[model samples]
Target: MDMSRLIETPLHRLAHGRTGDKGNRINISVIAYRAEFFPVIREQVTAERVAELFSHRRPTKVERYELPRLGALNFVIDDVLEGGVNDALNLDGHGKTNAFLVLSIPVWVPETILQLREEITA
Candidate 1:
């Protein structure tokens, strides 16, 4: 693969995410900034990668649900909250940090997409 045209960026640059919780499980949704960017995000970001990223939290399981029409991926992570909201030690017991942590995931995209991102931002 030609590396020059590929731009390595955190997932946040290509997508935005939100998170919620159900007991100890965290539900995170990642939506691509552009429809064209969805394929790259889908191909690069996998449940395995997410599981690896949250290894410190020791999630029992990670499942990814794809919403192609919405250009989104929803990840259900189990047992990362230290317990349910009432029992969690963190200030944001809903595992609010999960989405930002997931966004830290790195992805490689073509230069054209990078340009599109800049345009969207601008």
Candidate 2:
């Protein structure tokens, strides 16, 4: 509960994501850069949160599949493409932007994790 113990950062700082799509469904895979960060990413990033992030797309469903060994979380978002690339009115209907959108999600990390970096470089 101590505010000083936490730091907010974009998810991209702890992980990377890739976007894919098929028949109006969007798939995003988020992988943590370090094993130590996996648990935090898994705990903070949820399907419900992801659906909220892409609410403008009005996704019909959102599913999150976890791969702990790989330190990754894969999200399958349905009906987000507006009817697929060939049919969606949006110019970038491929859903390529979804990955970056998800990555921009703010993540709260323990200040200790941030301190690790400073200790390494000092």
Candidate 3:
């Protein structure tokens, strides 16, 4: 299908993510809300793309591991924490809010695949 015609929507509509951090590295898991949406995420949400999204954090490396059976993707980002929870000066240094940031990334999905919701129309 030609993706050019697809609508861009925040990832939260299709999936949810959680974050865990150890030292300067953070692990995030993006799981599709439905199996049908997995392929869309798998194709668009690459490790490089994710790293780009967090470019301000200056991650040294970003790795994505796929769990097709569970319709999920795990991302491990390195060198983003400034040291570790005990060492970083930021208020949310452990990076728990990073998951919500990831969920806000825009993804293009076929218009037909989306079920228009009243809330969105309003």
Cα lDDT, all candidates = 0.91, 0.87, 0.87
Backbone clash pairs for candidate 3 read: none
Of the two candidates 1 and 2, the one with more favorable lDDT, higher being better, is: 1
Q: What C-alpha RMSD separates each model from the true structure?
A: 1.8, 2.8, 3.0
Say which prediction, candidate 1 or candidate 3, comes out ahead on lDDT.
Answer: 1
1-122: candidate 2 lDDT, tens digit per residue: 32458899899788889999888898999998778778789999999999999898799999999999999999999999988988988878898987989999999998877555454346
Candidate 1 lands at a TM-score of 0.93
Order of quality (lDDT): 1, 2, 3
Once fitted onto the true fold, the runs of candidate 3 whose alpha carbons sit more than 4 angstroms away are: 1-5, 116-122
State which candidate has the highest lDDT. 1
Each model's TM-score, in the order given? 0.93, 0.89, 0.88
For candidate 1, lDDT tens digit of each residue in 1-122? 32448879999999999999889999999999999889999999999999999898799999999999999999999998987688998888988878999999999998876788877878
Q: Can you list the residue pairs that collide in candidate 2?
A: none
